[model samples]
Structure formats: structure tokens, C-alpha cells
Target: MNSARRFLLSFAACVALALGMAAPAAAQPFPLTFDAGWNGAGSPPLPASGFWDVQANWNNNFQAGTSNNVSPYAYYQETAVIGGDLVNSVGDLIATFAPVTVNVRTFQDTLGTSASSPAANRRAVAGVLVQNGSTLNIQSTGRLSVLVTYGTNGATTGLPTPGTGSVAVESGGMITIQTSGQLNVVDNIDINNGSMTVFPGALVTAQSINSGAAGTIALSGNASLTSTGSTTLNGTTTISGPNVVFNSGQVFMGDSTVFNPVITGGTHSIMNVNGPVTMNGTLRPQITGVTPTLASSWVLWDSTSTNGQFDFSDDSLTDLPDPGHRYNVATTTVGSVHGTRGLLIVENFLTAEVDRATGAVWLRNTANTGGVNITGYQISSASGSIDAAGFTSSLDDDNFDGG
Candidate 1:
């Protein structure tokens, strides 16, 4: 539904539940078909179009021009299939409460006029082509599963026609998940200049994320995001949480100006890509739980093969504590340690501290646990290199273990 009409419908659903409004005792709910006034409104003056939750818009046996709204109950928790197109003719947008599934058979926004239509004429849509500042909120009590194009009419009815429809959140559109809200998309999410925010305590699992040039995804607080397939992010992914996991497949990172992965204690953000990773842009890593000692290393990107490298010069690695050494990143084979090749940040320290008073030189064990040998190690200064045989004579009468 469009504008205040659509917002009022969502509000009314909440009020109806509070008022204990129930369907008729004889009414048996069934899968609703999106006829959308295709066959003139059964009731006059109400128009053929209506909201998804409204009783007048749905048809029980939808067959294009002959279907009628035989079902008297509004679809609250029933699985619905949008067969025909729903234009924002007069604010006929859709917003429901805790719907189990909303299958998009064809293009829901076939007309594609709502984006250019007036505010009063635009629909607050939840299906495909959710654009033009439309906001779809998944309540805490709701679990909305959007099954994108599969067959001719989604996964339910395998129509003869091949599925060519796709969903895109573009042009200021948003899908916000409230606390404890869950949204699972069977197909990839193409965020074309739009955004999806998962608030704290909320969860969103998608097949993959195809971020457009202007698209963005903000995972705030303790929200969890799991993308199963390959994710090629060309926009920004702002994550304030610690539970974002890219479990499998290749991940191509590109133009991520706001990507920051944090490391807290023994647990940190991980992108376990089973294939190659094409790296680009800046990856700002933060350490919160533990202090890094000399020769400490952390693996940020784990993959079988890496194509490119991140712009480390634009990172905040210098903010970390430097114990007479600097932190640098390198693409190395971590198979013996992590079973894959990855990009790791290591603290390289190899200088010795000399006690001039007693003429003692101390080389701390920064990398290994056992003793270190400096038998043939070169020690040079501004004047010249010290002779190995006569270097000990130049020092005070202090004991040298040589290890």
C-alpha cells in the first residue's frame, strides 16, 4: 500500500491482534493470489486494487481476468504468491505481519511507475522492485522469507516459463530488521544504490550479496549476517558487530570504503572463502581484547588463492602499539597453520638493546621460545663493522652465553 494507507495497514494489523480480532469460525485460510483488481472489484466503489492484508485484494482461485476475492479473511500468516503485477495506482502497497513466505512469481512492480509517481500514489512495497524510499520493516515477531524468482511462478508452481524476475533494493529503499527479527532470502540480494540494516539482536541470512556501486549494508550492534554464496561487494559494508561470517565461496572485495573487521580476544571476524579472493580498497582491522606482543601475527583474509592486495597504506595499522617494530601486511601461505593462503599482519622486530654501562648486548627472543644463536650475526655501526673475534675484547668483563 502507498503512503499513510500502507503505514496504517501495518499499524492496524498490530491493533487488530491487540483487540483479539480473529477470522470467522467457518473461514479456512488458503494461499492468496495477487489478482490485484485484474478482474474488476467484486465490491463497487472500493476499486479493484487493495493492500496485501486487506480482504478485498486477494483471490482464492486466481486465473487472470476471472478470479474473485472468494476468501473473506486477510492473509496474516499464510504463504502468498504474487502471480500478477501490482502497481502503485493509488497507494495499493503491501505490508503484513509475520508472513511465513511471500513468493514472487513474476515482476511485482511490472509497471515500475511507483518510483516516479506522486507520494500519494506510490505504494510502500515489500516484494520485488522495492525502491523510491520505500521502507520494509521486519518486526521482532516476524520471520519474512522472500523466495525470489525460481520458476515461472516461484518455487511453489513450476510454470513452463523460465524465471527471469529479480529483486533489487535501490534508490533510497531500505529493509530494516528489528530486534530479534529474521529475514532469509533464497537468492542473492542485489543492493543497487539501496541499503539493508540489521539492528542489534536481529539476523539476516542470504545466498549472497551483490553490492552495486552506490549500495550499502549496515550491520549494527550484535546483529548477525551470514552469506552462504560468493559475495562481490563493490559498495560499503559497515559492520559494528562481531558475528558476520562469509562461510564459503569466493569473495571479491572492491571499493569498500567503510569495511572494518575487528578482532576481540580469541574470536574475530572471519571471511572463510573456499576459493580465490580479489582484494581492493581499505580493510581497517581493530584489536580490542588482547595486547599484541612482538612477533604477533593475525590472519585477516583466508582463502585458497588471492588475486590482489588491500590498500594497506590507507589503513590504521600505525595506530597499534609499536614495540620497536612496525606492523605490516603480506600475502603468505598459511596452510601449515590455517590450512589456506591468507593475508596476515605480522610485527617484525629484529634489533638488539645494548647495555653500554656493562658492555652487554641483549637479543630478546621475540619469535621463538627456545634459545637463539647469534654466532655469525653481523653487528655494524656508523664507524665500521665489528670484528667477530675481537668484538668480545672490546666489551667489559661480562659473561656471554653466545646463545
Candidate 2:
């Protein structure tokens, strides 16, 4: 090759590198760092709020991956930094009203590894802030993974104090899933002061939903939530879902937990658990888009086993449509067809009747009973009077038990 041609090719390559728009290298786990600052000022200043996938929003034009491991997947393994600006280092991603897919697998900060005085610099800990009415959509293929953390720098003598990484959504911010969006969080979703809403036509299967102090998680409109690990409801977690399935773990509901499920006709919200449930919470059922009727009942939650019950200290049943009717939390053992055994909110004012000829007994309600599934109820009685000796009892049997 001639010297002139070689020089020209080398200059072109340098120009592309200087522009920071070089072609992508071979597929691998690479660092994609955010270039903007808290106030939208950095090497490549982005708007105060914008889409996350825009190439200019990242440093060195390092964009999020567009494909996943298998065919027809939206996201895959990606490691990205959230805060990297030297002057104003707090990374902010405000996605207002628009639907956004954070295709970056991990949002981390690497200042701990780069700076000399790691503790003195603010970049020691990397964090991302998603606020100002923003909505982030995380779509995954349900591949459970581990938590992504930051690295620590090595100073002259000993190792520097290790830094941390976090993702927070505050100020009415939401992490939601809609339409074909399915979120599978391999790590913890620490919404200590944020919200995560799984809308209708969407599903979210996570390892766990945790709150350091307080947070909110709402599910509504035929939405579903499947948790493989334990979930602690420490704050006001409102669930108006047709189904909330716990695959194989427990659920802890404390005093601060509140269940505000909306009933639309006979289709009310329910939590189906395959494991035990420990609750010391409150349930506030709301009737919506449907009128009050007789023989109506709503199953609050059902599980294979349960510990404590809701502390219904505050007259929560008064909010129902029928003010004159009575309500009670009835425990029912159900078959695998309907659901595992659980509790139900039914009309309390019931009349116990027995047919002496056949020993058939059933509950008759005169007031507005509301539409409730009566299949879970069973009736058994003693052969003789309460005061009689050698009294016998009938075998325990319910329709669901196939007896």
C-alpha cells in the first residue's frame, strides 16, 4: 500500500473515534454509560427528560441492545452506567407520558474504579433517578438473574471504600408493564419510596418486591403478578387484579398493608397462593361498575395455609354498597379446581337450616348476599342434642371434595 493511502485510512479511523460514533464491536457484555447530568449538562447534553434508547443520550454513543438471546425477544444481558458526568454526576431519566423500554440490563456506576480519591468524589456511588411523572417499562423473558452491583477502586495503598448502585423512582414515578410487556426482575425491585403498577394486558414475574421503608405496588384490570420469592407488603399496596399468583413462596403482610380490591360483577380480585400467607393487615373492598345484589360474595385471598387474619379495626365493610347488609370474613377450604383453601368476604346474616330426613344442611340468607361462590361451604351436625351423651357426628363433606 502507498504511504499516502495508508495515512488517509488511518486519519479516517481517528476521526470516527473522535466523533464517538464508531461501529459496535462483537456482541458481549459491555458498559453503556449515561452522558447527561442532573441538569442536562455534560459532554453530550440531553434534554431534561427524553427517551432512554436514543443513541445521543449515552456516552460514546453506547446504546442499549435491541435484541435478546432467542428469537422474538425484546431485551437481554446489558450492563450500563446511570451516572457518569464529572461536574454534575447524578443521572436522571425522566420519561414523561411516553412508553419507554429500559433495554439496558444493568444500570451501574463505575466511579469507584476510576477516581483516585474514591470516597471524596461524589461518583463513588452510582445511582439513577426516575422521577417527574416518568414511566419505565422493563420487558424480559422471565430469565431470573442476580443483583447487579458496582465495583470499588484500588487506591495507592489499600482498597478504597466500596461504592453502591441503585435505581429509584420517586415523585409519582412508576415502573409499569403494558400490552406485550412482561417484566422478570432477577434481582430485587427496591421501591422504598416509589411505585410499580402492572396494568391490564400485562404480566410481571419477579423474584421479590421489597421496600426499605415504604413503597406502593398496584395491580388492576386483568393484570397478573407471579412472585417466585417472598414479598413483603410494608406500605399501602393496592391490588385490584383478577389474579395474583404466588408460585412457591410465602407472603408477609404487616400492619401497614392494605388490600383495596375492586369488584366488577361476579369477577372480583383474588390472590391465589400455593404457599403459606402471614397477614396482620387490613382489607378494604370496593364495589365498582356493578350494582349490589343478593347472594354476592368476594374471595379476598386463598392459600394452602394462613397465619394471622386482617385486623379489621376500622369499619372497612361500611364502604360496600349495601349498608343494611352484614359481612363477615369466612374461612373456606377449597379444592384444587377453584383454588387452594382461603378466606372469603360473605354476607354474615345467614340462617342455618337442616333437613332431618336426609341430614342435608345449607345456609339461607334473607338480606343482600352479593354474588359469592358457595361451593367452598360444607355442613355437618351432631346426631343427638348438645346435652345428650354418646352423641355422634356426621362425616365432613363438601361438594368440592367429591363426597
Candidate 3:
């Protein structure tokens, strides 16, 4: 071989090594932060930490897994049920127009072909639209329910039930997701001007329904709504996020939406709202049952400002325990047995019936325990009556305890 030939070979080898090192690494999704704050600017590059902070806020009941995550920084106004290995982070959400229900499964097999089981994946979630960072808006209007459950208790295999990622609605656009589910948001959801109902397990028809359940669903600016319901009992669920608004017609209580396996819910149920608000309803805000109930539990349903009017009618609700049922309604004070509604109802340990459709109050389930202690609410519009005897404050058999 000649000297020139050897030199040429060496130069070529060096060039190959340089090129290899210059190549960039593979790119990941958004949420590149420990606290998940996208800096309120443009979304930065994403790492493998598992976060959706850069573009929009998120909500779920299952504990999100991400050892390196900050539990849940900030709060996603979107209402969703999530459960996974979450660290120290605050949930982001809003519950003025609707409430996003989350039932995060703590553990399950995440490497299976399909989800956990057929029954475990037929659950439902309801709430309002979502939004985050700039115009990255993803509306989840109407009811967003999924048959998503973790296979663990009494179950054989353990798998993550990545249920159908479909935001079932009548008109909102639709799209399939990578695995989770899809979203649906119509331009408007007013009962008067607009009327459409999407059954469970259906597809959405909103503008931009995505195939991922981890993005922003903002409804900001002039985005105002009445937050109606599919049924009389389904209208009480309100969950969303951001500086959003829930105009005057905003009310709760009814069955337009539902939450099966009533586990736990309430305003403290994790509902975050911005802008003015108004709340109205008669259904139980939160549910904590050992057996499992439907249409119960909530994260947040705030309506504290006077600017927002809260209308409450004891009759606008349905499916509630009737005379034959064991359940009852009563008002109670902290220390005392039965408190007072001042003018509301529920005398000390008394049973009363609340008309959800007419806002009327009556007496029922007089065969129960004392009245449920009314923490610290004395404001009354019109006092109600309570049946003595059997009027208990702490009992669950009153609603579903079939005779």
C-alpha cells in the first residue's frame, strides 16, 4: 500500500465517527419540568418524566405514575378520574360548567394487550371543557365517561384499563387516541339554543377531539355557558379549570350526568374555578360508600361569590330514596343532635324529602337515625320539616337498602 492510500483511509474513518456523534437524540412529548409549570410561555421540549404541563392542564382520578413528578403541580380545571403512582403535585381543574370525575386506579398491569376487564372498563366521567398555554384548547363538554378500572382487588390479572378514549357527545367532533380516550366539545351546549345528547360509549363531534387524554381543554375569554344536563339529575355535575366562567344559568342537581360506583365526591372533590360562579342543586355533593354506588362523589363544586347566584330546589332531583327507601335528609349542628335550617328544614334528627324537580321540601324516612349534623350553614330560604324517630344523621341504607 502507498502512504497516500493509508492517509485517506484514516481520514475517512474520522469523518464517520464525527457524523455519528453529531446526530440528535429522539424527541419526546411536552411537560419537561419537575413542577410541570411550562413557564407560562411556549411549551419546551419534553422529557420522559410523564407530564402534560407545557401545553395545557390535566385532571384524572387515577394516581398518575412518575416517581420523578412533583406529585401534581398546579391544578387542571378539567374534570377527570385518575389514579396511578403520583408523587407530590396539586391537581389542576375547574367545576363551574361541569365537574370532571376521576377514579385513578392505584396499581395494575400496564403491559397488557387490552384493558383489565369488560365490566372494569365501562365507567363514566362528566365535566366541562379544558384549556392551557396559548390556544391549545381541548373541550370535553357533555359527559366523559369510560369503563376504566384497575385489575387488582378480587380480580385475577392486574392490568391498566386504558378504556376507550372516546368523549361521547352528540355534536362535538371526535378523534381516536393512542390508548386512553378521545374528547368532544361543541361550540355551544345550551339547552335552549342547542339540544343534543350523546349516549355512553359513543363518539364525539367537536372541532378538535384528540386521541390523547392528557392535554388542554380551555374555554376562556367570552366562553360562557349555562352548564345544562342530559337528565334532570345529571345537571349538577360541574368541573373545569382556569379563569373560566359559569354565567347565571349555571346550576347543579339532576341526572343529565352520572358517576357510577359512588365512591367519593364533593366540591372538595378537587374542583377548581376561576372567574365568577353560581351553584344550584339538591343531590348529594359527595359520596363515600363501602359497597359502591353510582351518581355520587365530586371533587369541587364551588360557588362562593355573591356575583354568582346559587339556586337550590328540593325537587329538581330524581332517583333519590323514596318513602319505602331507608335514606333520608335532615340538618344538624356541630355538637347538637339536629341543628336548624333557620328556615330550611331538617329539625334535630328529623327526616325530610327534598323535591329536586320543584324545589319543594317534605318529610320522609322518619324511620332512621338522628339528622346529619349541618356543619356551619344557617342561611335559609324556607325552613323544612323532619320526621322524628328513626331520623339518623349517619347511615347509607336509606337510599339503596331495598326492603
Candidate 4:
């Protein structure tokens, strides 16, 4: 009876083996979880080393929540270095539900040589969605790159559109890039919260930037921001810095634009705005030099409106006007000047004044030989009173209306 029972048991075991049911269960992939700690309620530290996308070192449960449909809340506070690409295949890579502070650096040397290499250092093919009443603090001495997008899962496969997520760089915490690093954002960037500060040496290439409604982009200490493509502005954007160079492909200012920079007269570093600029604020040219004349012609307004005018109602020149140089407001269309109001005050040491009213160009000069020469548009204003300085002013014969 015992031998029969053993034989029956062996037969059942053999059958189970043949059916592939006796094999050990496969190991579940490790989810990237940041509990209180590995032991639950201790200081959490970053993993020694691993690829950002590896399941063994990551806890996918942390990304699940009401706002994000992926993972639950996880407290993340650590500084780590990633040696591989941090690509996200799920929905927006969100870090919320906790006061999260992560200083991440990527290994650039291991990144492949191709332009589209997934292992490219400091570059994230996925979009970083920071919202839901959460703040993400990132401070990187090495190159840190991210692709800003919206509405799609944070994937590293395609271009991104503007979404609800925002990336705010905390004040004094910087993302420094060496070796000509370029941080690209496909949509508009908001710096009005005053929580983010782009340092002087950092280079960011973006499509557009909104200096929040009452925000100011203070470019102090020789900081610079260059736009690789056309950009649009929607609020009151103020430029208050010294020797700050803002290079844009084309800028369309939808609201008031203010320029209050302390620039040297002959310096080649000037603010370059390549599109139609609608001046809704006071533009004060603060040029400084020994014989500081506005010679560089820095402010270029290429307007398409035939009646486009620079309303310098509140502008004051801080330096003398150079006789040999003409401050050109280069425009495309040609017609009678209109829509101009207020005093176009170009006051100089020689006390020469050039004013542009509706369809008229008025010049009052007290200096001799060197006068204001108007070009590119027809001057239709009646002659004004000449001053006692024996100064002369000339309007281009081709653009003069003889009114």
C-alpha cells in the first residue's frame, strides 16, 4: 500500500513538471519607491548607481496618485547621479505629494555619440511635469537637460507641446552647464515667481518666455538669455540689468516692454529683437562712455505697420548724441509718420532736440555743424524754432514731405 501511494505521488509530480506548473515563480521587477527609508522612517539616501529607467532600482508606485494616475505618494529627498538615460515611458514624470529635493547629475562620457542617443548626458527625453501643489527643487553643477512637453505620457520618443506642468528653479539654486550646454524648452517659460534665477553663465534656448504679469527678468552680473527660435511675450517684460545681452530669433511683444539697461556706448553686446516691437512702455537708453554718444544703434525696431511709431513719451537720453552716427529705427513700409505722441526727447550736451509728432519731424538744435539727420521716413511737420547754438538739422531729401 505504501509503494502504491509513492508511485502515485511521483506520477502527479511528473505531470505537474511537464505542464510547467512546478517551476519557481519569476521575480517581480523592483518598483522605484521612496518610503521614509529602506527600513521605513529613516533618512532616505540615493541608490549607489543604476540606470534611471531600470525597474530594479526604481519604485514606480511613487508616481501613482489622484493627480497622476501612475503611482502613489512617496517622499523623495536625495542627491543622486545617473549613469544611464532617464527615459520615462509612463505618463508625465511628476514629483509631488512631498517636499522633494533632488540634485541629479548625468554621466556625459557614457552618452553615445549620436545626436539622438538616448544615453546623452544631462538630457531627459521625457517631460517633467511639476504641479499638483508640489515643488521640485533641482540644483546641478553638471549639465541638466529636460524636454518640456504637455498632454502626453512623458516619453522620450517625440517632440513635446505646452502642458500644465511647470519647472521652477529655486532662487540661488542654479543649473550650471559647462562646454556650451544648451537647455531647450519647446514652449514658454515663466520666471515671474522669483523662485528661479538663471545664472550668468547658464545658456537656455527656448521658444518663448513670459515674465509673469508683474515679474521682472533682472539680468544682473552680465547674465544673458538667447532664443534659438522665434519667441512671444504676453505680459509686462522688464529688462533691468547691466551689459545684459538678450538675443532672440524674433520677439513679438504682445504687451508692454520695458528696457532699463546700463550699457556702454560702443559695446557690441546689445539687445537684439528681430520682430515687430510694439512699445507700450518707456524705453530709456542708458549709454555710458567717456564721450558717450549713442553710436552703436542698439535698439532696432523693424515694424511692418506703415504708421508704426516709437512713442518715447517718457524716454530720456543719458548720453550725448554722436553727430556722425544716426540712431536708426529701421522699418519696412514707407508712408507719412503717424501715431506718434509725447516728446521724443534726444537731449544732449549740445542741447539739440528731435521730436516726432503726428506726420511731422521737429528738430530744435543749439549745437553747430552736427545735427539730427532723419532717414527712411517722410518728415511732414512744419519747421520749428531754431535755437541760439547755431546748430543745424537735416532730413533726408528722399523722405521729406516738404509740408
Please give the RMSD to the true structure for each candidate, in Å. 15.7, 15.1, 21.7, 15.2
- For model 4, state the Cα shift of residue 327 in Å: 10
How does candidate 2 fare on TM-score?
0.51
Candidate 1 per-residue lDDT over residues 99-118, each given as its tens digit: 11121121121211221222
In model 3, what lDDT does residue 37 have?
A: 19
Per-prediction backbone clash count = 4, 8, 128, 12
**Tens-digit per-residue lDDT, 265-320, candidate 4:** 44323455554345444354555563543433343323223123334433355645
Please report, as a residue range, the 10-residue window in candidate 4 with the lowest summed lDDT. 70-79
Candidates ranked, most accurate by TM-score first: 2, 1, 4, 3
lDDT scores in order = 0.49, 0.46, 0.26, 0.35
Better of 1 and 4 by lDDT: 1
* Cα lDDT tens digits for candidate 3, 106-206: 21112222222212222222222222111111223222322222223323232222222212222222212211222333222222111222222323333
User: Would you give me the overall lDDT of model 2?
Assistant: 0.46
| Residue 302 lDDT (model 4) | 30
Alpha carbon lDDT at 152, candidate 4: 17
Query: Any runs in candidate 4 off by more than 4 Å, and if so which?
Result: 1-141, 148-182, 192-196, 219-224, 234-247, 271-274, 289-403
- For each candidate, what TM-score against the reference? 0.51, 0.51, 0.23, 0.43
Q: Candidate 2, clashing residue pairs?
A: 295-369, 295-370, 295-371, 296-369, 296-370, 296-371, 297-371, 297-372
Model 4, global lDDT: 0.35
Question: How many clashing residue pairs, candidate 1?
Answer: 4
Candidate 3, superposed: residue stretches over 4 Å from native: 1-268, 281-299, 303-368, 371-403
Shift in Å, residue 19, candidate 2: 35
Candidate 1 vs candidate 3, TM-score winner = 1
